[model samples]
Target: MKKRRGLSFSQRRAMSGFLFCLPFILGFLLMFLVPMLQSIQYAFSSMQLGLDGIMLRFVGLKNFRTALFADPEYVRTIAESVRDMVLQVPVILVFSLFVSLLLNQKFRGRALARAIFFLPVIVVSGIILEILSTDYLSASIMSGQETIGAFRGVGSYEILVAMGMPQKLIDIMIPVVYDIFNLVWSSGVQILMFLAGLQTVPDSMYECARLEGATAWEAFWKITFPLISPMLLMNVVYSVADYFTTSMNPVIRMINQQTSNMKFEYAAGLSWMYLAVVLVLLGAVYWFMNKRIVYVGE
Candidate 1:
């Protein structure tokens, strides 16, 4: 092989990889960066639909002031959205891990099972979720017309509900009662990431643990959990974002309505503010979880 001047084989390979990604890099800057800057500009302005219905004028920082201090529903809506994020993140993480463990099991039909778990990541979109939203699986329970709900009655809680479980126990489960639904609908990516992480764990590590008289549960707690912690962190962030931006999400609907009503500047400000809050929360999660993660290669 002829040695290239200045650039080694690996360096040349890196350059080729950068060249391959050039189109995506350019598109991201053009499509996302320019629009994002424009949005930030608009967020500070006081643009509104005029009486002629096709004009706009600037009234700087008024939109932000209205959203922060004057608007009736803006604060409440944002608070509710953030509350949902906090609740949903942990619920999604635990349930996704549970489902992933099942999918990772060595079973005859495991591939099919994994596909079923991943259906949501593939098929979930605005249209499909809109169709499902009309069904309102939680409506009965929410309205107190039924003792329990549809999917909750059937899936993970089936055994307890059928066995005449205590009402208190059921009540306690209410906070995360529909978590299985969230899990089933969100497990696609997390399961795949977990499977990837599981592959990275060498079987020899388990063998060594076994030789040291470590039980299966001990091996999982000491070896498997730490090894996969980074993937766990990634899935947590993805699930939180996915929940907030989902088509079926109420906050997104509210934002859509604001846009349709031509409240462009206000909507833009709200979106930017909301995005900042989410970024801060995600940054906090990363900071707190980063140290706990064990880098197996190191």
Candidate 2:
């Protein structure tokens, strides 16, 4: 009999990755797929909980129509959520990258600093974050009359107005700046991801750049940025998903409200519509960023 050839290194690595992902793949199919299909079906039907169990009647596009046209606040809330996402994702990504870079440097208590930064991911649940926002954090940030007066008196708002910026734009920027802490807190996982990516960069590349008399800024653009471009894309996608699904998201809160009110079919329609919008935006981002990502092998 002819001897069988052993698997190559690349093939073995591919198999290992597939094995690692098997559990998640199985869980997604078993747990998420059925409910997702049911929800889609419900979106096209009227659902009622009955003594017999549940009743679903074909309602065609009525639920979609109601969510889109009948509900006054649904579309507006979605629009607001999208606008917040646009403002928040970039800030989160930048903050995460900055923190990751800082943490990657050798320093006293580096591990402790990383743990401190990542503590929010472990301890700050949705309810806890909400409580903190309502009780002490947001109150302190927004209630400082002196700080508010100083900001206003500094001609910051006036400068923007004189620069012909719209009042709506100014309104969005103020709240976003005030909520920067919350945005930074949301970057814990992203910071960790960037740290991992940063560790993957070969030190020799930086040493070579240094030998060439490159400044830290030049080395960063020439070596670090391109090397971490993949991580940037990953963080962008994660941030988008996290922002949309977080409890503070107005769209998600609206959906939860509908579910609480037993408007199951309407909520399903709304969720499906929101999911489509997210997918479209995600696709656009992926398309734009995918072209710019530089692979080390490439």
Candidate 3:
């Protein structure tokens, strides 16, 4: 009987995907969209709390002007945040990738090693992490001479001093060196993502490369790197977002300070600007990396 035709496989698959995403779409619209719109409105308006609630008055570009010209520290803090992001993201990526490769190798206590690497992600999260920073738990526990952050950097700084390197070079290296522990802590998620990607590599490909007399390095470049390129892009995006949003980020701290001092409109404007900057960076990264990512079938 000439009744009805069902949807094609592709159409059905697309429908399924849409259904899977529907909840998130609805949530974004229903829950998050209003606040986001309000934030944009707040950015351009002067807001004051009254007996009722937030009272917003149209202020046009005043908040933006305040942030850009009136406040010197705002731009400086943002610049520092961006500078730290540029310095940190690559180091974190390389460190996580290298450690993932090591942990993927056949060895005793490999699981333990992976767990050790990942422990920070579980432990150093949320307000707990904030409380455990230098001003809090660290200050309470560490002696004057044995401060954790200083202790970690002191050895490296001394070694470099002994080496008679240029002061400018030493100044550069010292920050990166001092942040070694922080980098490690921040790397836990990236390391885990890399391990997931590494596990997806088929053993047969490596075996074939070995049979073809390819060295480990050649195998890595030819096989592993191409395959893991996708995950590398993911890690880059993640690291960028994490760096910009972390508790230690000066930009965020500045915004929080504004909010705390009841500078709601100004805070909103600063936040919107920061969000735009981050979004632009993320868009550029995704575009560049998406072009380079290798799919197995391709």
Candidate 4:
């Protein structure tokens, strides 16, 4: 009898990945599919409450048109959401990677350091984030009700002037500077992801590089970075998603307002548009990063 062929190593790996993702695929189909389709239908229709149930009248983009042309705040909030995502994702990724690198190094209290960095992931939750995002809290801080918030006063502005930055640029950077705490707070998960990736990099590769007279920078650039590129891509996608959907996002707040006011179709339209923007951004990120990402064994 002829010997039967077995799957290739690559084929086995592919099958394993598929099996790992099978639960998520099944969950999405079973739990999310119907609600997602109904929400999409809501984006293009008017809702009516009848004795039977909620009836949807297909309106052919009227809801979308109203959201775009009629609501002034919608456009501004959307623009702000995108702008915040653009600004914060890079900062978050860089900070996460930097902290992860430090955490990956052998040092006293390494475990404690890792735990400290990841504490934000445990401590921050939806309710806490909502409170943090409150306008009243921001106003209180900015108006000097809090000592830390009083940093908004004069020092950074003076430093920027002394350094000769443009006033417009200073205005943008000042808010971002004050938001540093939030940025750092948001990086816990990405840091954990990066740490995982960093740990997977073999010590032998660094030893070999050292024996070859490679500087620490050279070793990092030549070995550590290339090996971690896949995780870098993953963290970037996560950061983008988190920034665009966070409780602090004005766009999401606006959508929630619409929903609360019984404007279900309008809210659906807003959410769908927001989702479209996020999907496009994630697609662009994947396209740009995929070519740069180095997979193991590749």
Which candidate ranks first by TM-score, i.e. highest? Answer: 2
Clashes of each: 1, 0, 0, 0
Q: Give one digit per residue, the lDDT tens place, for model 2 in 1-298.
A: 9999999999999999999999999999989999999999999999888899989999899998998899899899989989988997998898999999999999999999999889889767677656765664354443333335534656677888899999898888866776665766788999999999999999999999989999999998989999999999999999998889876688988999999999888889999999999999899999999999998888
Clashing pairs in 2: none
- Give the candidate number with the greatest lDDT: 2
TM-score of 4: 0.77
Candidate 1 vs candidate 4, lDDT winner = 4
Please state the error at residue 155 of candidate 4 in Å: 20
On residues 82-112, what C-alpha lDDT tens digit does candidate 3 reach at each position? 8979897999999999999999999999999
Candidate 3 lDDT for residue 18: 100
Q: Model 1, 87-156: lDDT tens per residue?
A: 7678767777777777777989998988888887776657775565555564333222333565455454
Name the lDDT of candidate 1: 0.76
lDDT of candidates 1 onward, in order: 0.76, 0.86, 0.85, 0.83
User: Residue 238's C-alpha lDDT in candidate 1?
Assistant: 83
Candidate 2, position 266, lDDT: 89
Location of the lowest summed lDDT over 10 successive residues in candidate 1: 138-147
Candidate 4 segments whose C-alpha is farther than 4 A from its true place: 1-26, 50-53, 125-178
Best-to-worst order by TM-score is: 2, 3, 1, 4
Error of 1 at 285 (Å): 1.0
Which residue pairs does candidate 4 place in steric collision? none
